[model samples]
Target: MRTLPSTGPRYEPPRPGSNGASPFLPPLPSSRTPIDPPDPIEPVEPIEVEPPPEPERRKLRVVDVQDRASLGGAALAGLSLTWVLYSRILPTEGTLGFIVCWWLSFTAFYLLLTGLRRGRVVLADRFAVLLAHSGAALVGIALATVIGYTLIRGAPALMHWNFFSQDLRTAGPLEPLSTGGALHALAGTLIQITMAIAVTLPLGVLCAVYLTEVGGRASRLVRSVVEAMTALPSIVAGLFAYVVLLISFGMRLSGFVAAMAISVMMLPIIARSSEVVLRLVPSGLREASLALGATQWRTVWSVVLPTARPGLATALVLGTARGIGETSPVLLTAGYTTYLNLNPFSGPMTSLPLFTFKMSQSPENNYISRAFGAAALLLVLVLLLFAFSRWLAGRGRSGAR
Candidate 1:
């Protein structure tokens, strides 16, 4: 390439709207440039966001058990119960299999529950609970149905006037089984139970009141004694009554002696139950009563006792149930007689339980049937008493309210 001259004039291109003129359009003022002024800068704003609330933790529910486990437990429990029932009825020698089945069923249920709860929500857990509950309900219903059926089957012998009116002296298997009633046994049971209640109720309530209210330094000793009393065997109580009342006083077996024995059995149960109920009474109510210028006794009677009446009644009913069912003590204390005896102190009296015992031993099938009927009747009486106690308690509660 040839070298160019160093001092030559160079040509230049025209700028946009130079000299206030445009090549394609009208020209603008020379002071103003063709390029627009830089646009005003705007401040940048930061983005806003909120973190989500923490996820709630799932709670365990009763229904979370695995299906296999639940079924197994139910099966085991059923098998065990059946084995026990069969053993009771047949006096079987091989109890091991029954026991094993029972335990296995229970274990299976537990396993099922554990297996079902993997990575589940609270609602899902309830399925296992419902299953268990339903199983229990079904078992209870089945047992009740069987008992009711048996009781009904045996009740015909109990319906006749003679069943209530005639003594065992007049009753023979050959004699119309429907002719005799359990009136004498009924009377004896009533008398014995009434006497037992009379003896136990005041003593038990007082002991409980003392334990809950007045007992301080000696409370532990009292509690220990009460607990010991609770464990006292019925036969032991019967023997005690026999020794104390019958042997000591040269008294023959009678309703009174049986009543004393039953009272001894009932006292501890009543005391323990009453104490629990009394303790459950609201402290605020007691304080309020005291603040209102009521004495401690007044406060207890007016506020505490009234509030705990329902539980107290329940205790009484339970005590009566226990007392009425006691056969050993009654057998030891009250000599059974076929004839009706109204005098609790003088003659041997027959109670429903004693009558049932005696009747069961009879060689005749009729007597056995009568025994079952008597048992059913006894159960019904207990239920009635329970209902009555509940009704009374409810009424008292409503009145308080």
Candidate 2:
């Protein structure tokens, strides 16, 4: 207690006040200097984010065209070409120039349209491409038009009965040119074609069957040889027939010899066509047939053949068309006749093609007309054959299913 001398002020616990104040509290102190609230916190300025600069607007490209200049050039070119074509300055010159002009003009217009549609600057290069295509189309149209015009112009001469019913021997230029009918030629053609079909159909079908169904190394070699034969010239076939039948056998030139020659010509065509058609028959059919205990031959006969009958018929008709229209072989082997001859072996016979060729060679204009008529007839006949074949093929295909 000696040193406790002035220990600081004594502490005392505070007591609660009557107004719900805490008991442990100090009395309010008075100060001479005013107490200020702590300085107010500084406010942050809002961020001055300038909006992104307005996006630059994209500029649109403008197409500049010298319309008047292009059109004027085009018009001048067209007019010049027209003049040249119509004036006929040279042989077929007008036709050629007109064709060229039409193509150029069409091309120009096409390019102009394209450029306008695409909003592209019309340049000469674009026009050049258009012009090229136009030129090709014009050339094609010109050729077709010329041919049609020529054929139509020649039609009047072909309308007379004398054109189809007369032979050249009885016809003279001044005498209305009527003498013999095409009946003889028609008969010869039918006989030769019939014989050709008879020989070619069996041989061709067999060859096709062997190649497709029974083919082996030997069959491949045979097919190769046949393919090579297909390219042989009609003149060569004619010469061969002439030498073999007329000279070697001391046989008269007749429809029979012509038929044999034509058969040679038709064989490869028929064989190739038939082979392709037969091979196209699905292998599943053959397999199913065999699985049913059918022999290979039976499967081919009953299943394969029936399925491909249409194609086979088409091949035969095509072969007939090929043989019936032949002139060279028939000319060399059969020899032409004015009167009808039913016998294939005894005398010279004329076919439609041979008749046309002979008629066209005569000096009389009537003969020329007759040649045209014969040509038209022959064309019609072949077309009918094709139509019939197609019909048969359709029926066969439907029936097979």
Candidate 3:
């Protein structure tokens, strides 16, 4: 390569300690540069943040004052409108018709007011509540009226002490209320029901057990038959008993035969109800029992039966209620009699239902009073049975605890 000629004087780097320092020399401190103290770290006080204010608590209440006010307003409006329509606009009406119209108007006005004040959700809820309350109220009113009317109509006969002590054997349709009592009818009813319960309870519970614990094709068949029997009319049951025992076997009408007829009605009811109750028993219990090496029979008898005792009592009550009020079967099988017959195996028996029916057919006021009195007694008996069942159920619950 050939050298080229320079254009000007050549550049030279400065020596060490001169205007610039050499790269090999160590760095030197400068007095002009200020040295600041390290930043002072002031202690930060803990943040004194107050806890968020506790939310105000409000107690929830059912049926507030506003609800009561709204209800009163609706009732007043409904009653006023009903009175105006019935008295001024309508041609004629009875108490029942006016009451029904007032109820309809009240419900409509209440729903309208609720929808206006609240929204659709609240309106729907209020409507549902109102419907439930109205249905319960109507049921209560109907029961009260029936009981009140029955007691009022039967007061003349019920007030007499002898009406419960004597039988209709010495009494006539024209006889005074004090002359005779429903002793025979009462005895017959008690005896028949007792016998029916005795015959049906064990069999029904066993059938239920078989259906629940030993379910098979046979169980399904039995269940079908039981369901069919539940719909069997009282008259059909009566007719069957009349045909089989009376016609075929030459068995005479007696309380025993009446009990047999009643059993036909009671058996299916008890079985079906017991089956439902048994099905409600937890499978866990059965598994636990089996795990403990208890046999199936022992588990059912000791564990299952005791656990379902209260429900079984309920089943008993149901069967008793169905059988006790049966008139057609008793009339067909027992052949009603006015005279008191203590022996159920031999003679005709007079039950409360039969006595009520017979007395109601008579034209005499005294007879009608007796009929009503008998009917009232039947109601009392049913109440007693219900109370007894509840007592038994409560006892079982306490025992379990």
- TM-scores, each model vs. reference: 0.66, 0.69, 0.77
Cα deviation at 162, candidate 1, in Å, is 2.9
Quality of model 1 by C-alpha lDDT: 0.80
Task: Name the top lDDT candidate.
Answer: 3
Cα lDDT tens digits, model 3, 253-366, are 899999999998789999999999899888989999999999999999988988998888977986798799889998899987988999999989989999999999999989
- Against the unseen true structure, what C-alpha lDDT does each candidate score? 0.80, 0.77, 0.87
Higher-lDDT candidate among 1 and 3?
3
**Superposing all C-alpha atoms, what RMSD in Å does each candidate have to the true structure?**
22.9, 26.1, 22.4
lDDT of 3 at 52: 79
| Deviating ranges (above 4 Å) for candidate 3 | 1-54, 57-67, 88-90, 104-128, 215-217, 281-296
Q: Once model 2 is optimally superposed onto the true structure by TM-score, how far is the C-alpha of residue 286 displaced, in angstroms? A: 1.2
Candidate 2, residues 45-121: lDDT per residue as tens digits? 45556677889987564333654455555667666665666455544555666766655664566556556655454
Shift of residue 61 alpha carbon in model 1, Å: 11
Segments of candidate 2 deviating more than 4 angstroms: 1-93, 112-169, 172-174, 177-179, 396-401
